[model samples]
Every structure is written in C-alpha cells, then in structure tokens.
Target chain A: MARKLLLEHAQVPGINTYEVYRKHGGYRSVEKALKTMSPDEVVDEVKKSGLRGRGGAGFPTGMKWSFLAKPEGVPRYLVCNADESEPGTFKDRYLMEKIPHLLVEGMITSSYALGANTSYIYIRGEYSWILFILEKAIAEAYANGWLGKNIQGSGYDLDLYVNIGGGAYICGEETALIESLEGKRGNPRIKPPFPAVKGLWQCPTVVNNVETIAAVVPIVNDGGEEYAKIGIGKSTGTKLISASGNINKPGVYEIEMNISVEEFIYSDEWCGGIKNGKKLKACVPGGSSVPILPHFLVCKTANGDTRMMTYESLADGGFATGSMLGSGGFIVYDEDQCIVRNTWNFARFYAHESCGQCSPCREGTGWMEKVLHRLEHGGGKMSDIDLLVDVAKKIEGNTICPLGDAAAWPVSAAIRHFREEFEWHVNDPKAAMERNYGLVNEKVNA
Target chain B: MPKVTIDGQTIEVAEGTTILNAARQIGGELVPPAMCYYSTLKGSGGKCRTCLVRVTKGSEKDPRPMPKLVASCQTMVMDGMEVASKSDPSVVDARAAVTEFLLINHPLDCPICDQAGECHLQDLAFEHGKSNTRYEFERRTFEKIDIGPYIKLHMTRCIMCFRCVFTAQQLCPERVHGIIHRGDHAEISTFIEKSIDSEFSGNVIDVCPVGALTDRTFRFKSRVWFLNPMDAHRDCPTCSGKAVVWMYGGEIYRVTARKDKYGEVHDFICNTCRFHTKEKGSWTIEGPRDLDRHSVISQNHYEHGEKTVR
Candidate 1:
C-alpha cells in the first residue's frame, strides 16, 4: 500500500533516531519552508490544502492561522498544544515518540510560517520518557543547527521550548493552555480574543495540536491539491485513530479519511474485529466525548455508507445516529461489556478533569458520577435511571466549554443506546455488580 | 449594527451580539431566560436552558429552528431576526423541563443555603419550573466532600452550572476548581486530591448558581435570606478583592466574597483574606505597643473616665 502523509515513513523501524529519520526524509520540510516558501505562501498552501485540525474540533488549520493578529510586525507565537489529555486519544504520543524530529521539524516550519521566532511544545506530564526523548531530540536539532538561528544558513531564526503540564484536561483548550504556559493554573479564558488574536503573553499566538502540526510537514512537501485529492469530499486527509477496547488488535491505525466504520473495525488492516470473537454491542466512534452508536445503528450507518470517516459522514445524522471524529479516539464495546459501566468510567474521567470553573459541569459532573457509581455498584433504583438520563441531558451543551458537552455525550449516548444496561444494574443489582466486578478483575488480569 | 426585533420592541445592537444580550440591550416585552450568560465574560456557558427563545419570524430557513428553543446565549443577533421569549410554547417547555431536570437531584436545603437569596435555581423554579418533581427515587447524594478550607461541599444541592469553574478561570489565576467526571455521573472536584487552594476560591461559593458548593466557614451560620451583606473590604496583605463579610447580631460570622467588586481594578484576593480575614468584631480592642497583638485591655483601663491602651 502506498502510505500517504501519515504513514509514509511510519513503517520504518527505529525512526526515533535522528539519522534514521533523516534517511526517511525528515527535517526537509523545515529547510524547504525557510529557504524557499514564503510564510504567506506556506499559509496559502495550507489554506488551499484544506487541512483541518486533528484535535477533535476539526477547525480549518489555515483559517485558524489566518485569524492571527498581524498588526504590522508584532511578535506572534507558535505553541504546539501537546497537552493530549483527551481520553482515548493517543495518536500524538506515538508520532512524537517515534519521530521526535518530525514534531520539532514541523514546529520549526509552522513557527516560521506563523511569524513566530519562539515556540513551545506543551506536553502532558505523564510522558516522562517522551519528555526525555523530546529534550534529547531538541538538543540534537540545536546541535545540528536545525532548531537555533540561521538553520542551514537560511537566516530564519526560531527557538523551541517544552513546558510540562500539571496534568489538566482544560489546558488542552487553547486559551487555558496559554494560561498554563504563563505559569498559572490551567483554566480556560473567556474567549473574545481567542489565542490567535491576544494569546500567550497577550501576543498573537497560533496553537496547533501535535498531530496537526506534524501533518503540516507533509502538506508543504507534497503539493496542496495533491494532498487534498487523497480523501473523499470535505474529509480530505488520512486520520490516525486510537482504536482500543474489545478489539482483537487494539492499536492506532492510520486509515484514509473516507474508510468505513466496518472496514476500520473488522478489517485485519485496522482493528481486526472484536476480541475473543465477541459480538459488537456498541461503539463510541470517535473519542469518549462523542455520542456512542449502538451496534444496530452503527451497522446500519456503516452498511448504508461504506465510506464514513470524514467529519461530514461521521456526523451525517448528528446525535440521532452519527458520532464525531473527536481526536480520533475510537473505543469499541463488545456485547458482554456493560455500556453503563463504560460510560461511568468516562464520566469519572471528565468529572476528575473539569477545572471546576462552572457549576453545571462541576456540580452536575459530581451528581452524575455519584448516580452512575450508585447505578453501577447496585444501590440504584428505577427512577435513578431516569435521573441519570435527565442529568446527562441537563449537563449537555450547558457549560463553559465542550467539557460539559463532552461529559454529557457519553452519559446521554449510553442511556440512549443502552438504558437496558443501566436498568439491569438498577433492576437486578446483584447481577450487575457481579458483571461489573468481573470486568474490573478481567481488566486487572488483562 | 443589526436591527433586531426582540419581542415586539425593535432595537439595534452592535454586530456579533448574541440574541439574549440583544434582548437585554433593548428592554423586551418577551422575558428571555439568559441564566448561564454573564456578558461581563465574553460570550460563554450557554448551559442553562433558561435563555432559550423561539425565532418565530424572519429568516426562511430557520423559520422553525431545529432546537425550536435555541439557547439565546449562543445564537448571535441577525438582522430582522424576531425572538419570541414569553409567548413561545417550545421555549417555555424547554425551560420548564430543564429547570425540573436540574432540580430533581437538588436537595431542599435552600432554607439554609448561603446562595438562596440570589440563586438562579430559586428564581427559575418559581418562574418557569414545575412545582413538584415526579421522581420517586432517592436524590443523588455525595458525602459533602471537603475540597479545601475556603470552599465547602453540599453535593445534594448542586445544579451543575459552569459559573464556578468559569469564575475560577477568570477571578482566580490558579486551577483550584473543575469538573471531574463525564455525563450524568460527572462531579465537580479538585485536582487529584489536593485542596481547592486558590486566591479566589471564595468566588466559587458565590458563583455556584446553587448551594451544592458553599463556604465552609459560613456553613449553618446564616441563611441567604437573613444575613444582610455588609459592604466591606479587606486590607489583607495579598488581595484587595472586596470582602463583603456577612454579619448577624452585630457580629461578622463569615468573610465571603463580594461579587460586585470583582473587576480589573480590585478583587484579586489571596490566601490571606481567604484564611486570615477574621471578623472585626472578634478584635480584643487593644494596641500592640505594650504587649502582644491579641492582648486585650484590662477592665482597670476600661473605666468610663479612664484612658484606654494608646
């Protein structure tokens, strides 16, 4: 298979090394961008390529770049929002760890394009090993004159720094990320002056996800129109999805944007179908934040359209059936697994990460957590099931950021698709408890 | 500027102004529920379904909007857009449903809630919500997790507004408060197990739309309907965020946040006001010249004719 942008050198073993990366055509984009393409040309090329952010939002990357405040030469910043705290989304870690130079090269090129002399990679703190790898890789780039001033004597100056996050999901929000970078707590700023306008240090900034920036390297090398032709319709590009949970081969797979859900799941080239030959019960097509699709509905959607990976196709019918390609965190559920319990896990994650800024998200998350915990562990009543659905609906689209909606989607989706699971827990507490604890033990053993 | 008609009143507002704000800009006959929006903070948190309004006229494609009751907090103002807040059936139904749903798990501890007087829950309940819940189940409960010294928990009374979380972002520089879980099972929790240790942790108590979150020091001291908030400021070494300490029986019982004064000029309080800002009535009435700071003047110097410690 002719691997496109993401998988071009993805199969190359030990590409983490600078020499191996160089051999596989890395750092060429930075050299090309600085020595040849003007910053404006780079932006125009990206605009033409129609490259959207891979960080869940699917915002147009070039449009986001165009939003920058260019007041005739004020310092702009290029911040790589590597705070990949989104649950089930682990594509960036593989890319950054496998080819650290790829990110650095991407950052250098993107920074130059955004008119930024300084850049910072904000990595989530859990990746200590990745942190060390990046630090060393950055040192290598510095030594090779690729990161520091006058790289390859092109007279393009750029500096990069890595900021360690205190482990916050809110920091992933651009403005909140800027606040954390400014040495404050990771809380989202009220937007009006989005980061592109008055970001990091009150200067114009462009915050791109790790995968988003890395994608830029390829966009520049291959012509924009050529890159655009790979994917179907508006979903123009390959996506690296973190396919975990109940799958035979639970791994990150980079598939064309138009690949079907069935192909992505059952194809040996991707998830390799359900584990232990289990029946598919349901699937959270995107990240935990997107709505969960029931096996019946998902199959219907998949059967009706064998090509449904793009933003438009995946969300073709909105919440009624479709799910979002948020951060490409694809989690599948087998028939035996309880949807309520699975949703509770996601609820627990969001409640933990909520920055406690707003009441609905803060208070509602807690309320939902307690209710879900009760329902899952066996103390819940029938009305509790209704209450859970009600609370989930209340929390959805109600808070400051998508966090509220993120919290709401899984609960609402779980109840909508599998209220029977929660009813089983509430109606037959002992059996549900037995099932839940069994899964917990199974998880531990696995 | 866009010419928008809110209710029956025709008005003009700056472009990009949300429909809710536009209605608020020009006094409208239709009462739109703008519960989650705080115009002070640039367009946010349309979580509360209260600000929902029906765009009954103008614009053919959206003559009948999908949501039917769109959150006016999110929908920006458009030219010739007509909003039906009071008369709209869908808006009323959505609001009533939202309020009832919000109040289902919320405890009946409002009599003792510090936010009872100024709470959106209380106002919305009487105005838009059903008087009683059909839910015949045990309300969702948390064991009143003590997040920090500054903030208290009463999980039974929460309504899940993002105001506290948003307030933490703006008023407090640090991340002391945030949501912990997802969906109906989500909870507002501190980072890891650490306390909500922030300079502006008290604002969380104030911004908590409901009593789910409360001030620990003032718990059970005074109900919101009773204690008159005496306007005051703290001369604490760190923050000057106006500390409107609550007083009862001529004695200050709680040193809570004064929301009116939180702005660019002042209201940036730190740990000093949060922890050490005690009631002035608690003072011993003695100078620190002769003895220690807490030393009180003796009755010998307290005579009507006698001079006090100077």
Candidate 2:
C-alpha cells in the first residue's frame, strides 16, 4: 500500500513539539482551509475524498460533519472520542504517546472547519499520562500562534480541554462520551436526537474518534479528492488496527481499506501470522465485541466469497455470517485454542461489563456466562449447548444500546460455527478443560 | 391512538409503546413471565428471555410466526400488531429455557439468601422452569470480590448485567462496577482495588439481576416476601425517589431500590441517600411500604393517624 504523504513524519524525533511540527508543514492545512476554502467546500472535499471514520465505526468523516444539525446561536462543539478502552486496541495510544502535535494540528484544523470554537477530547481515565502530554502540547500550541486567537492571521479562535472518563466501556458510544464529559456516569442515551443534534450540554456537537480526527489534518492538507484516490470505495482511507493475541508481531499497523483477509493473516505487515505458525482457529475481526469468525469463514464468506478487511466487505453477510469493524480490535486465536472456552470468557466480560440497567443484558449476560463457563468446565450436558445458543439469542437485540448485541456476537457465532466443540465439552468435560484451559490465567492474575 | 391485538384481545394504545409496556396498559396482568425484568432497572434485559411472546401478525419479519417469539421487553407495540403471550406454547418453551439457562450458574446459596422468597428466579421457575435440570456440570465460581462496602460478593451468584454498575457509575462514575473477565467466565468487578465502598453500593443488592451481588447489611437478614414494603422518601435524606422500605414489627427489615419521577429526572441521593422510615401509617396497612410519603400527606388523611415507628 502507498504510504500516504502525511503519515511520513509521524514517528520522527521532535515531531511532538510545535516548532518541529511547524517546520515539517504542520497547521498549514488550517491556514489553507481557514484562509482560502469555505467550510462547506472543506466538508464537500472530505466527502469526495471518501474518508471514513478511523475510530472503528468506519463512517464517512465528511458525511458525519454534514450530519451535524446547523442550530443557530448555539455553540457547536467538537469531541475527540479518545476513550480507547477496547481490549487489545491501542493504536490511538501509540499515536498520542508519540505524536501529540499531529493530533493537535488535526484538532485545530477539524475544529476550525466545523465552526467549533471549543473542543473537548474525552480521553480514557487510564490515559492520564497521555492527558498530561496533551496538556503540555496544548500549552505549546498556545505559545506559538498555532492555537489561540487569529491563527496565522485567519481570524479564528479554538480552545481545547481534556475530559477524562470515569472508566466506562460504554463511553465510546458518542452520547455516553458526552455524558461523561458533562461529569456524569457514561450511560448511552437513546438516539433519534443523535449527538449531532443535542449533544454535550444540549448544544450541537461533533464526536469523532481520535484517529478519525487525527486523519483530518491529512484530509485538509492533501485535499479530499487526492485522499479519495488512495483507498477502495466505501471503505475509503487507511485504518489503524491494533492487532494482538497469539500473533508473531502483536502491535499496531496502518493498512488501507480493502486488504484481503487472507493477506492480512499471512502477511507480516499486520499480525505476522499466528504464533508458532499454528493453524488459525477463530478470529474476532473487530474487537471483542464483533462476531467470532472461524478460520474457514474468516477467509471467505458463507457463500464462498473471499472476505476483505473493509467496512462493507467484512459486514457483507450481515452479523450472522459477517463481523463489524468496531474499534479495529483484531484478536486472533490459534488452532489449539478452545472456541467454547473463548466464547465463555467473552460472556464473562459482557456479564461483568453489563451496566445491569436493562434486564435482558444484565441477567442474560450472567446466564450466558454461567452456561458458557459450565459448558467449558466439562459440566455441560448436550442440552447445555442449545441453552447457550438460546441465552445468546435472548440478549442479542435487547437493551438500551448496541452493547447487548456486542456481548451476544461471540457466543452466538461460536455456537453457530463450532457447536461441536461445545458438544465435545459436554461429552467429555475434564478432557476439554485440561486441553484448552490456559494456565496463563495464573500469569495474568500474578 | 393505534389499535393493537394482544393474545386475541384487541386494545387501543398510544403510538410507539413497547409490547411489554403496552400489555401493562390492558390492566390487570396477562400471565406474564420474566426472569430478567424490573421496570425500576432502567432498560430491560431481554436476557433471561422469560418475557418471550409470539407475534402472530402485524410485523413484517414474522408474518406467519410459529414457534418464533420476540421478547416483549424489546418489541414495541405497533398499530394492528397482533401478539399472543397468554397462551403461546413457544412462550412457555422460551421461558423454560431462560429459567434453565439462569440455573446453570445459580449457586445453592439461595437458602441463605435474603432475596429467596421474593427472588424473581424462584417465581419464574415456579411458573415455567423444569424441576429437574440435567446440568451436572461444575458451577462457574469466582472468589468473592466486594462490589461495595455495603454490598457483599458471591460473584458466583452475579449475572454480570450492569444495573448496579449503572447505579454506581451514574451516581459517581469512578466508583462503579466493571466487567473483569471475557466471554463465558466474565464477571462485573470494581475498577479500583478498594472494596465496593460507594454510597450507592447498597443499591446493587436490590438491582442485582440475580443473587451474585447481595447486600452485606440485608443478606441473611430476613426473607423478602415476609417483610412489608412501604413507600416513602429515600430517607438517606440526601437522595431522591419514593423509597420502598420493607418493615416487619416496626423495624426496617429491607429496602427494595426504587426510582420515582424525582430520581429518574435527576439521579442523586439514589446514590448516597440513607433511606429510613420517618413515621408509620395506620396499622390497617399490610406488608411492606411501597408508598411515597411525600405524596401521601393528604391521601385518606392517613398522615393524621401517623405513629412514631422509628
């Protein structure tokens, strides 16, 4: 894939400082867009560029800006969704840790374009050090003419603040993020009046993922049409995936959309192949929340179509057969891994994480966890497999937000693709437990 | 108003009402079965799935629905929507499976539980669950982790739904519940290493979908059914909501968490409030007080006969 021109200066020394950033052509996009181009033209440019959200939803960036309800006499705000709590996804952490100025430049440009005078980055509470770096960077940007007042004489002002979350996975949901920003618990509000309508403080708001905002500086500098020419249609632009779990090179990688699932697995550029060259067993292509895809199905859809690593392609067969690009948390499992145990572990997470407000999710997540754990621990009977499926089905589409569905995907998918593994556990519980249960749990606890 | 048919009975309801909430509109109950539902819990679980009711007509997806049942907790009542919840055989089957699934992890600790007689699981099982389960598997167990100073851990009894977490966090974000495990063995744990020491911690005991999360203060205190519930202010004085304080022999035995018009509009003392009975009503009243004393200042002149219960 062609390394887009903007991300080249990302990892260099002094790149975090405002001076070095300026020397390497930083904030020029803000100058160009603010001084020369109309905000509408910028929105149109991003739309034409086919830049989708890099924050895992894969929504079009410009299109999302366009969706902002243009409420008059109200202070429109920009919220950089930096609550990167998805397990195994840490690409945003690396970017903020290494290149704070890049994100600052992007925030300035994106904020100016959206007519947002004030912006808040709702960062995860665990990233306090990252928050400190951002504060220092913000102070530095102010010291230079890059931030406050007329930036490079463009007659625009932007102020940024870091709002830390109180530790919630649901805050990744935009409204929840807004609620957390307002210093409240991060329960997602009902939609229809989306964040763009009545968001943070009941004002117009634009909540973009951190990478989604970081990608904006490039969109402004390179121009939308130029950026559009780079990636495939629909799944436009490059995505930063945090690939981890039983892989040769377990880290972050920036890959363009439309890469084949086969190549991403085999190529050293992403996961560097499964650990010890073990045959692949199953994969949760989009964080722990997306559906689990077996090796065979991960390579191709149920209709024998090869699956590509893109928003549209991966989700081609719908949720039953397809998985979402949520949070780009690619988790791969080796052939020796037990699907039942893995599914059980995920149930435990959902059950534990469930806010317990909604009954189906609260009770169902626990029920699913218990059943899955029971099945995995060799106490499962044949009827237990069906019971697991039934529990997952109950929680699939019920509850306040998509978190319920997220919790159900792995269980339902595991049962759908590997019901035999569950049955095997029922047939011989002790063997299954001794075979797949990892002793590393001791390591994890210790 | 849109006319809808529920279990062969037609009724008109306002637009955009949920079938569960709509069934509530038809007055009296319709033999409803639910393992994971509590209107006070904010959003419905739709998890225990005991609330499954077949939709025979009025929905496009399942026009010729047979054994197909949608969770009434989730599916909204629509115009001309036809539902069969009263006598749907599939509903019974689904509820049975839900009961069985819930039992897979239910500890034998219920005999010692304060929620025993009032537990929804016990009730749902009586209504639709099988007496004998073939699940001879070892129950998934987690060493006790305190959710709050007031609430005790028996994680083995926890279902991992986040009603307690939401209450904890929504009241005070940093001091709430968290999911510790992944997949089947996952559990809701506290983020900090400290004991679940939040003021809202006691709410977990009442909001818990199962026995996993229990109140240290109330657990093993008394059988829930035997206690009388009375409605009054969340006596925590700092909190809002019509408190549901259960009393036996003029002593507060237990308190079922409640969210009234006040608490829902603004989530506060429902957090750090200490609910207690300020005064007693006439002795003619039965078990448990589920009243809002603030609103009963004029109801049947009951306040005039108030006794010093506290």
Q: Which candidate is the best by lDDT?
A: 1
Candidate 2 achieves a global lDDT of: 0.71
For candidate 2, what is the TM-score? 0.70
lDDT of 2 by residue, A59-173 (tens): 7788899988877799999999999877768888988887888888888888877899999888998898899989889999888887888877878888888877766677887
Restricted to chain B, the TM-score per model reads 0.77, 0.76
Candidate with maximal TM-score: 1
Model 1, residue A98: what's the lDDT?
76
- lDDT for each of the candidates? 0.74, 0.71
Q: After superposition, how far is residue A69 of candidate 2 from its true place, in Å?
A: 3.1
**Cα lDDT tens digits for candidate 1, A1-446:** 42567656766887777888888888888878888899999998888888889999999999999989988767889999898888888888888877788899889889888889999999988877788889988998899889788878988888899988877788898888999999976767755557888999989999999988988888898867777887877777778889899999997777778667887889888889999998998888778899998887665564476437778877867787778888999888897788878888988888787776554566567677777887887888888877877777766655556787888888887887787777888888887776766765675678
Docking class of 1: incorrect
User: Taking the tens digit of each residue's C-alpha lDDT, what string does model 1 give over B1-310?
Assistant: 7787776787888988878767766753464655556555433455656776777664434554433456777777777778887777756766776676677667777666676655667667766767676555577688778887767777667666666667777776776677665444457777775786666676666556667777777777766445545656634556654565555666667665445311111254555664566657533322211211111211223355535522
Q: Candidate 1: lDDT over CA atoms?
A: 0.74
